[model samples]
Target: MEAARLAPEDVLPASEGITPAWPGRSVAVDGANIHVRDTPGRSATVEPAVYVHGLGGSSLNWTDLAGLLADYLDGQAIDLPGFGRSDPARSYTVTAFADRVIRWIEHSDRGPVHLFGNSLGGAVAVCVAGTRPELLRSLTLVSPAMPFLDPRRSFHGRLLPLLLIPRADWLAARRLAAIDPADLARMVIESCFADPSRFPEQRFAEAVEEARLRYTVPEYTSAYVRTLRSLILSFVRAYLPGSASLWQVARRISTPTLVIGGQRDMLVDVRVAAQVARTIPDSRLLTLHDVGHVAQMEAPRMVARAVLGMLSEASSVKLVPRTGASERPKRARRNTKSKRDIPFGGGITPAGEAAG
Candidate 1:
């Protein structure tokens, strides 16, 4: 079956009142202090959901969307090691990030929870879902940094050459130090949002504050550089035929998936969005026009509505637990009605063709 495409008007707008970042605390996982922002669900019956941010992004990125989904999800946005308030880790590889997430979920005993990731985090989430399908009830990727060989497609392309320069991290740090945090924040807002003018002033202030804090962390620059380099290398590996690439991992994913992308995303091409849905066996696609890289931040209410619809559909099917590493979870009979049958604030029109 083809993936459904949601129209701009079909999505609801976020609440007018902005909420502060969710309450956060440090949790020890695998000998590392991982910071997490916790959003209390409206009811005890709500399922657990974990949100992961992209490279150079912090847990604060998820504040609005987590709050909006509070009724159905007990959400926790995690600051991957070296980002946000989290302590630095020895390694910044995607696999390492995925390992930390796995340990946290195991430590919290929150297996089979809903998982969401944006950009780099989307790649990490893909790693987790592919290797440990038993750990996720569903997967949602927002503008995932999939392997795209064309460097011209994203702003990130400019930095790829830096990976070859010796002590590039130090050079990058010195360069960033020259820019004011407020200016850095503005750059981010401009890059991530199709309409930067539409961003709330208060939110921009918060972003500036977060950027200032990140600068104080000694490992911030190195972490960012290493992670970016690693991600690009992974992309290169993904292109090699017959290799165990992310695309290969994505095909193995069995969890229900939702892939969201902004039409104007400057970092990840919007065309890649449809390709992602087509890659995953049980996945849907959402491409929002006029939106940018951070759809969750740019269109939280719309993201929330699509998420709720997926959750509604997932609830109808029963999942059997995996008894061994080699065993795939058994899925019970799914409802005859398509996921579109589950209302998402309004009617939706299937793109009428397979995702590209």
Candidate 2:
């Protein structure tokens, strides 16, 4: 679980005002322009990992974690359609998003990849693994947006209650557009972090500026609304022909999987992580106490260590057995150490002890 020592040249400063430190370049995927963070210097033998961000998040979200793993993994993070610099597609369905990722992987001709996703992206990764397991070598999900009835834990859960009326999205967009960017940024940080202080000041300022820029885009609000609607629809589409419930899809996945959850996560309930781990037959769960919704952003070193640890043991990592309805996942012992390298199996033990 040691953090990779990123060299001075390997690290890029946070971009002026808007962009985060991650390096991005536009590339077409599934006939749509995709802005991706393509980190350099991966060994030829190591399998590349593709990162997918959550709703409203761009590939820039993966910057710190991607850099930490760059030595061991050829990492690239995608700005899903309608997010980041990518143009919104006509359809923003979860399946459509998953298909684009699958197509991109296929186009790379790099064979199966180690896929990592956060929140909404995690759910999308599950779709990809269930439908096209052949394209993935492994799967890592951080607080995936699994179906939950609790409004406190899900955007759809809350949105559904208000969207029974027509044009709800249109109305929601107008309200969202009225929010000041700086206020919106602070709100996001409050919602996502267990301790807002964990985020660096420079990055926070950049994020606020980025939020301001996003608010000014003519298509951003509509894109946000459309994507949010699609996300909600995916959870209830089990009745659709050829569609499967997230639980059902989880059962169909054979790829090695890692599920990470933050105990204090406000968005995706941490208790749900155990169910997700149990449902995905070949999966392991790591629950970090006191961490929030965005563990990668709030606890990048721990995430980097867990992911690298998972990759290092890709062939031998054993899956935890499905727990009973009341059984809970093991919680890791919290650590208070600052950013530094630890051993390969640093944070998590073979017995599911979570490192703080």
- The number of the candidate with the highest TM-score is 1
Candidate 2 lDDT tens digits, 1-356: 22111122212222112223766788876577988888653334446789999888888778777765654567789888888888778888788889888877887776588898899899989999999988888998998987665566653356666556677666866777889888888888888887776666666766787788786666776676777777777666643555477767878999888888888888786777777887887777777776788888776766765665566566532222222312322223223332222222333323335422
TM-score of each: 0.87, 0.80
The C-alpha lDDT values of all candidates are: 0.80, 0.71
Model 2 error, position 220 (Å): 2.1
Which 10 residues in a row give candidate 1 its minimum summed lDDT? 333-342
TM-score of candidate 1 against the unseen true structure: 0.87
The TM-score measured for candidate 2 stands at: 0.80
The candidate maximizing lDDT is 1
